[model samples]
Target: MKLTNKITIIALAAIAAGSFLALAQTPANNNIVDEIVWVVGDEAVFRSDIEEELQQLRAEGSALPPNPYCVIPEQLAVQKLYLHQAKMDTIEAPEGQLNNQVERRLDYMEAGLGSREKVEQYFHKSYAALRNQLREVMRTQYIIGQVQENLTKDVKATPSLVKKYFAAMPEDSIPYVPLQVETQIIMVYPQVPQSEIDAIKDRLRDISERVNNGESEFATQAIMYSEDGSAMQGGELGYHGRADWVPEFSNVAFQLSDPKKVSRIVETEYGYHIIQLIDKRGEQVNVRHILLRPHVSSADLEKARLNLDSLRNEIVKGKFTFDEAARYASHDKDTRNNRGVMMNQKTGSSRFEMQDLPPEVATVVEKMQPGDISQAFVMKDPKRNQDVVAVVRLTSRTPGHRANLAEDYNQIKEMYLAARKQEVIDEWVEQKIKNTYTRIEESWGNCDFRYKGWKK
Candidate 1:
């Protein structure tokens, strides 16, 4: 019983900013009990924290032991381990990212249970205070992840180990995998009108100069002018890696030096931007920026449609195959470069599943037969505030059901990689427990631990 309790606690703590502690329990009288339950290094665990966690679990209608208090010390012990590892690794996450994460989570929680106002009433704090608390907790959690990753990075499990692990699992425990594909792609962005591009760049330069001349604070200006969703929070991109951002934005953002100064106008597939550097350490950099995009012309769009329409007519008249016209007559170099093979971004497969088609194209292609060309339809990109005319060809279709080894190899490979990573991490945690100075309050002695050496 103790072993089961310990495992659950450790698993829960391993997730970022995960806390039952955020929930407030309904006791006979008060919810905020200030009593100390356990202490780890300099960190003290409170009875209220456990009760709050219990409240959340019960609210979710989760089954729990009648003796709920028995797990209190177990949770404390797990937190102590996580906190210690976090301190050693110096892990950090940005305040803005943490805040957004918390807000979205709270929103989901509210939808599931109650509103933020009610949540605050239960916690005895404002929404702002709760955000601050979660941010700090997440920061510590990041450290723990960093330390665990560093420790496990070298402990690779081989193919044989994976087969062994799979064989040990019960038949019912294996889930039917879904259809998935994986492919690598090099995207070619369509060329933007030179005049339109210049105009956006000019507008950004003007906005930057206004900030430079003391017109407004960079964040405030970003809030007013930035096109990204982060603009709501003063264009704070939050702490993220280069892979998270579009290539053009990432390229310029990493190059800027001054946090307070504005960057040169930059163009990306998304649109145009004037960026301001925020902070950097190692490979991570935070930035705030504003985007400006020019509107598309109806006249210009009709011109493109008329041109493509004529080319399509020529194809039907037997002058050329659709591919031949696509290579020479299409204005969009992105599709033209590959003879017009549209790849699904998520799956990276050359063949798009029905749902994989873009919304605008999907509506048209649903009624289309293979080898049929869709009439030129309009689609708008929010960043660019421009409508583009595109024609989709229904290349292939597959019925959905259980995934196969051949069709879902990439998905299976990812799952395999994840399982191996977890095994590596488990070993690493066992080692960390062995080396770290740990003193679990007498209450946790009954809990079974995978790391037997920690008993000392």
Candidate 2:
């Protein structure tokens, strides 16, 4: 009873547009009653919810399903089933993950709308209120995902089943594997001068001292100076476990027992920070901090580019192999030890489709052929929040072709496992719908549903 692709797309669009909140508010038409359209267990689905979803779909210029009235309510009803099961099982959504997701969503909204103020204006609520609402939506999504995972955790695609599944597929039904490449890179981080590092540390120390001496509030300092996304909320990082934070940040954050004390300057991959404890609950701690990053001078960047250019020329002239150079000279820790072969984090593989590479990397690699080394180029290293110079070698390329058992076993296996998992989930949803108590308004129940048991 999971939502069909059309419904799922509409739901995601509505959520992003903040139309989900319309369910709780009255419709603009004063004559139309906000009547209950369906009830599943103790939860009620209102007509306004369906109307709001439809309005969001129309606003986005999305084509509506022929039976949107029936489809939308059924989607809501199925969500209720998953939610109810999650509650019964006491499945708690990870708060740290939820907080991070909400923050990212807020950041995206702010970026799109031009500022935090515009985001609030667009949502018609205060930032805190909007965050809470987004948090609940994200929490529901997380719990539903967890519940679905729980139901299908044991489903697997064995080798025999994979072969059988591939054999049964019609010739036209087989998927096309896209052209992918394996790239090797050598990266050099532009060195920050000690003077810049010392300057940042000194600034943080001054901020910490001011807060400790009651000359300034830590929150105010964070708002004024913190470089992190949490600066909008006065650098407040809500309660999160030590595992949720980098070790350097968590170690100092958890050590703070006094709310009045300001922490010593702590350095992390992101930047330098001075923390102030807000509260602690069990293993989780909430804190506020201001972050400052040492500036990478133009001279340093030029030096890095020159060094990488020299190394690339040497490798191109066969003075040393690309892999050999990367092993000793590359600053990218993730790939340096692995002979500079980049792995796709999403797929846990050594191959990447063109669009999957970082934009800068993709642009350079697109024009390169197998065994060709690229010229030195500058790109942002998101992991360390710095700009780095690098050269890449396109080691191998696989051209696009139809998937087959011999050459595409792993890909086919993944496809089979995903299909099997969906089957298990769909069957579970069907049973849940049959067993669960449901009531629909007669007029709303007139249309057909994908799942049969909902009518009764």
Candidate 3:
């Protein structure tokens, strides 16, 4: 999920610079400086590959050490170990999958590299030729991932092991567990009464009628009436797949075949829509629409607020427990099952690192103490189209600290398991490098490696 360049560097994904015929000038052991840094069976690790990634890193403003060449070799060694294992285990992607992924990624890389022509010019090849080279490299990476996943499939965690793992970590080496608080609230969307919905629908039907009657152009009417962001641009949302859009909108949009005909009012969470499908291909559709959300009734807000006040009074009087109240009364489904214990959706754990919590929830939690409940307040729910009133529940709070076995067993166990897994993988790689066919280029004859037997 993270496209961050820093995370990519820290992961040490594929380490090795491609060693080419025209790389660093070194004619030490070999008469010709061109040498293979290491070989895995028939495949070789060159200085070029690592150098490219390092150059990419540097361009991204990474502060790199002067010793990237050394670090890259080890990374390349690990990647080769994985690559070798992948071939052995038949972890290979079909030509078609690699082709598709390469094509999709190429689009992004092309944009990043500036343009299609620019990219082709830099690589000194036509688009098709460049794609073929990228495909081969991508296929190797894909196979390596499959091999690693296969090896790690059986890794399991246990409570006792998790505890011991945390205990073994040095105090400073342990990650600081962030402060978190849990709470939940019930939200009632700002009210749009039936009459208002019907009025908006009627107005949309009139627009559709005008377009159908040929009295007015669809784009012009849309410019004057459409409420969505694309209104100014003639209501063109461009071509999009069904999966990319909200279900209700896509279902109707994708179904429309006639360009001249205007569709019925489509109701999505965004609002009511009257759409004109411009075109379609298989599961993809292009459409333009006018959206209208009904105005919220003040009476609806009062009704919700009055109900919340009654609920609050009941909680104060101990007539109903918070859990029971949330179960029977809360409208938000995510927390309703957990008795309204509002954990972050992005992180499954109940605790939210201060940075990880949603802004609205964080603001509420920041000003409150443990066990305090906020007065009913209205806030906009990002998922919904309207404002809603809900009370905040400030449960337990934990501050940042060095992880301990008692307070942070799960995290410790994860870290311990990860460390153990890394050690096991390292041992496996060491054995593989020793047993596999390997030859360091004469130019790299003097550089030290963790596995000394690789030279033979």
Clashes of each: 1, 0, 14
Per-prediction CA RMSD (Å): 7.6, 4.7, 7.9
User: Where in model 1 is the C-alpha error above 4 Å?
Assistant: 1-46, 55-136, 147-226, 234-265, 275-288, 306-357, 364-375, 381-386, 393-396, 416-456
lDDT of 1 at 191: 40
Highest TM-score model number? 2
Write candidate 2's Cα lDDT for 192-282 as tens digits. Answer: 8999899999899888889999999998998899888778677887767789888999999999999988999998878799999998866
> What is the clash count of model 2?
0
Give the deviation of candidate 2 from the true structure as CA RMSD.
4.7
Poorest 10 consecutive residues of model 1 by lDDT?
180-189
Q: Tell me the RMSD of model 3 versus the true structure.
A: 7.9
Alpha carbon deviation, residue 258, candidate 2 (Å)? 4.0
All candidates in order of TM-score, best leading? 2, 3, 1
Ranking by lDDT: 2, 3, 1
| lDDT value, residue 44 of candidate 3 | 66
> Residue 339 in candidate 2 has what lDDT?
98
Candidate 1 vs candidate 2, TM-score winner: 2
lDDT of 1 by residue, 1-456 (tens): 122121123223322333433344433225465555555445555555566556556654667755566565554555567656665666566665665555555544443444557767765667776566555555556656666677667754465655565566567655564332221111112345789877777778888898888887887877777776566556766555677688888888998897878988887766788888878856677788787666667777776666556656676678977677667755555667777777666656575655665566666766766667666656653234456666655665544555444554454555667877777766765665677555555664565554555456
* Residue 88 miss distance in model 2 (angstroms): 4.8
Which regions of candidate 3 are displaced past 4 Å? 1-37, 92-143, 199-265, 270-303, 448-453
lDDT of each: 0.60, 0.82, 0.67
Error at 27, model 2, angstroms: 6.4
